[model samples]
Target: MLHVNGEAFEVRDAAVGESLLFVLRERLGLMGTKGACEQGECGSCTVLIDEQLVCSCLVLAAGAQRQRITTIEGIATETPTDVQRALVDAGAVQCGFCTPGLVVAAHSLLERSPRPSESEIREELSGNVCRCTGYGRIIDAVQRVAVSRASAREVGL
Candidate 1:
């Protein structure tokens, strides 16, 4: 059994057949996690395993016996999350197919490195692919969030 997003589930007897994406979508009904390029090329199936970004499609549900899993829904704060707000502010969200994964990746990077440089942000989000927005806006969004967080930290707010 594992606890996900503060919910307890019985997976000890669960079938060892499906991928984590299938179990998350089919069994748990956590639709926020997307499935694109099931081969793990795209980060659409990205999720946090102990706060690290991982492709859910490439992971086996049974392997997550006692790990903490955080999906896009779970990572979202009551305040729309800094990355979410920055994406919207920078007009980075388009089509929205990639936003969830992008958000998760950005969240992971921000958590580990609060004030990452532009190159660092790019490296961290390299796993995610977006067909819209030309990536400029997305880059701008990430930078904006990093700047904002840095300012907050400096001001002790």
Candidate 2:
């Protein structure tokens, strides 16, 4: 059994060597987690295992039992998150293959730091690689979300 997106899914058919990325995309039908390089080098298959950002491609599905797994699909409700909106507004999404992972990474960084420095954002998101938009816009998106969130907090909203 694997706990994903606040739900429990029985993964009885997962092989010992099967990766969490495969189980998430194939068995669970959570296509939000993209699979680029099957290796851990690419963060396209990134997810949160117990609130920690991880490359799902490097994780074992069966090994994730009892752990909380949050995918891009679980990050927001019906509407897009502030980070997601900022990413779009900043024109950071192109090809979109790397967006999910970048979103997850940025979300994790903001959750921990709330208002991170430019270098901090770059360091945290270093794992994700976006070939389409370079990285300037992606950094801008994260910074934008951080500022927006801070403003919301100040207004008690």
Candidate 3:
């Protein structure tokens, strides 16, 4: 059984060595987690395990038992979060293969540093690679979100 995306699922036939990535995509049909590289080098399968970011591909399904997992679907919800909107508005997503993991990583960064500078955002998002754009827009997106949050706090939103 797995608790994923705020729901409980019985992954009854999971193999002992099966990864949480496999369980999320193949067994549970949550395709948002891309299996790029499958070696944990790429952050495409990033998910929050007990609020800490980890590569789902590196986590064995059996090891994930009773742990809370939050995927991209879990983050965006019905309405996109500030970071998601900023990324789209800044045209950061090109191939979108790395967006989910990037989003998860960015969310984690913001949780730690609400007003991260450009260098901070870049350093934090370095793990999630994109083959499409040069990451200028991605950096801009995180910056925009950071600025927006700062503004919102001033306005008490």
Candidate 4:
């Protein structure tokens, strides 16, 4: 059993040896956790296991047992997450293949360090590769989100 997106899902024995990414996409139909390089280089299959970032493709299904796995689908409630909205507003999303992972990574970073510097943001999101963009815009997106979130917190929003 895996608790994902605040829902309990049972994984059949047939998928015991599969990767978490496989289980999330094929069996559970949670395609927001995209899988690009199965080797964990692309970072497209990134997910928050107990609030810690990990590549779903490299994480064995059984290894994620009892962990609080949060995917892109669980990042926001009624509207898109602040990170997601910032990415789109900053034009950081290009082909969108890497958008989900980027959003997840940004959310994780912001959760840990709400006011990360530009250098810190780059270091945190370095694992996520975006072939389409040069990453300048992505950095801008994360910065924008961090700034606005701080502003909101100050006002108790």
Candidate 5:
């Protein structure tokens, strides 16, 4: 059994060496976790395991059996998350192949640091590689979400 997206799923017919990325996208049909670089070089397979951002491609599926996993699908509800909306509003999404990883990384950063400096945001998101948008818009989107969240907190919203 694997815990994913706040639900438990029984994994079946999985090989011993199957990567978590394969289990997520292939076995469970959670295609949000992309498999760009199976060697963990690219952040396309980024996911949250026990609230820690990790490259799913590097993790063994069987090893992640009891851990809490959160994919891109798990990050948003019926309505898009502020980070998701901010990315779109700021024109950060280009090809969109890297958007999910960027969104997850930014969300994790904001959860840890509600008010991060520009450099901090860049450092936090350094692992995620966006081939498009040149990263300026992506950084801007993260900052926008941070500012919006801070304002909401101040207004007690």
Candidate 6:
């Protein structure tokens, strides 16, 4: 059995050794999770399993069974997590290939550290590689999100 995107599924008879990335993009059509490198080195396949970021390409689909997994689609459909909106407003998106994974990583970081410092943001996102934006803009985006979220919390907004 599997529960994905707020839905229940019966996968008891399904294959036992498929990567979560394959099941997501091939079976479920959730292609927001990129398949870059196909290895765990690049964080492009990042997804949240029980709110912790993991490389879907390296994770077994069976291991994700019953766990709450969040992908780029899930985040985009919501109110655009503060990190996402900041990324856009900060002009951090270029090429756009790495945005989804970066967004997922940022979401995990914010969930755990809410007010992460610049160095923390850099360290957290080090695994994700971006060919455009030169990373300066990406760091700025994360910092912007952290600041904006802090302000919102202070005013109870």
Candidate lDDT scores, in order, read: 0.87, 0.92, 0.90, 0.89, 0.92, 0.85
The CA-based lDDT of model 2 is what?
A: 0.92
The candidate, 1 or 4, that scores higher on lDDT is 4
Judging by lDDT, tell me the better candidate of 3 and 5: 5
lDDT of 2 by residue, 1-157 (tens): 8899999988767678899999999889999999989988879999999999999999988788999999999996589988889999999998999999988999999999999999999899989988999899999999999999999999999
Q: In candidate 4, how many Å is residue 79 off? A: 1.7
Which 10-residue window of candidate 5 scores lowest in summed lDDT? 33-42
**lDDT minimum window of 10 residues, candidate 4:** 9-18
What lDDT tens digits, residue by residue, belong to model 3 across residues 68-120? 99999999888899888998999998889999999999999999999998888
Per-residue alpha-carbon lDDT of candidate 1 for residues 31-65, written as tens digits (9 for 90 to 100): 98999899988898999887778999998998886
Superposition TM-score, candidate 2 onto the true structure: 0.97
Better of 2 and 3 by lDDT: 2
CA RMSD for every model? 1.7, 0.9, 1.0, 1.3, 0.7, 1.8
Q: How does candidate 5 score on lDDT?
A: 0.92
**Candidate with maximal TM-score:** 5
Report model 1's TM-score to 2 decimal places. Answer: 0.93
| Model 2: per-residue Cα lDDT at residue 72 | 95
Model 3: residues with Cα > 4 Å off, grouped in runs: none
Candidate 4: tens digits of C-alpha lDDT, residues 40-144: 899999999988999999999888888899998898657997788888899899899999998889989988998899899989998899999899999999889
Determine the C-alpha RMSD for candidate 2 after optimal superposition of all C-alphas: 0.9
Q: Between the candidate structures 3 and 5, which one is better when assessed by TM-score?
A: 5
